[model samples]
Target: MTTTAPMKRRAILAFMLDRPGVLNKIAMLIRRKMYNVETLTVCKTTQPGTSRMTITLREDSDDKMRQVIKQIEKSTEVISARELDMNESFWREVAIVKLEADEGRLETLKRTYPFETLDSQGNGCFIVQVTGTSQLIDDFLKDAGSDSIIDVARSGFTAMEK
Candidate 1:
């Protein structure tokens, strides 16, 4: 019998107290549990003194993931932690890519990809913004070519249930 399960990507949404050291504590907890985090996005919510965090990682076992959530909820700073169902939830990521290309290539790229030009320098460097799913961003980067890309910054997956 097979002893290992295939690893699957998972996202956990956590609501926690908006105070100092809360992020550090939660990060330490996940780190100690040996889960590798792929992306983490945290921001203050509309509710005063509260914040929400969206963390994406890969895990092979559902039971172990639930156990990790239970452990996280035990923290005084965390209000709750639950896994988000990718099929039932809406998620998006934002990316800013800087590329070195001439005006003609830049125009061609703008027409080919769904990206907005944020700024352009006289030195043929252009900064653009694209917002979509992770896969969309990956495809955009790949299509843009590695030789033309100078830098990239991405805001990890932010998700909400339908």
Candidate 2:
């Protein structure tokens, strides 16, 4: 008999916490399990003294992922932890890129990509900002072309499932 390894899928975990180091502890727990994080985003919740952590992990088994979620929820600082379904989630990411372009090219770029010009230096460096889905940002970068890119800064991702 032959068996195949489980295919890896992306899982997002939202952690509701009331104290500090919870993020570190959660990450350490996952690290101890040898799972790699693809993207992690943390922010203060609207409720005071509580925060939310949005973590994306690449895992093969749903059961194992659930177990990890349980571990996170078991922590003293974590009030609750749950998986966010991608299908029912609203997600967003922001990216700022600096590229080499002139007045004409910048105009063309502004029209082509959903990016705003932050500043256009006299030295031919144009800084642009974009915010949207991860896929949309990636597609913009891919189509933006690499040769002109001088630098890039991206805010990982944040999501809420509806």
Scored by lDDT, the top model is 1
Candidate 2 has an lDDT of 0.80
- TM-score of each candidate structure, all chains considered together: 0.91, 0.87
Per-candidate total of colliding backbone pairs: 0, 0
- The models' CA-based lDDT, in order, is 0.91, 0.80
Superposition-based RMSD of candidate 1 using all C-alpha atoms, in angstroms: 2.8
Off by over 4 Å in 1: 1-6
CA lDDT, candidate 1, residue 92: 92
Error of 2 at 156 (Å): 0.8
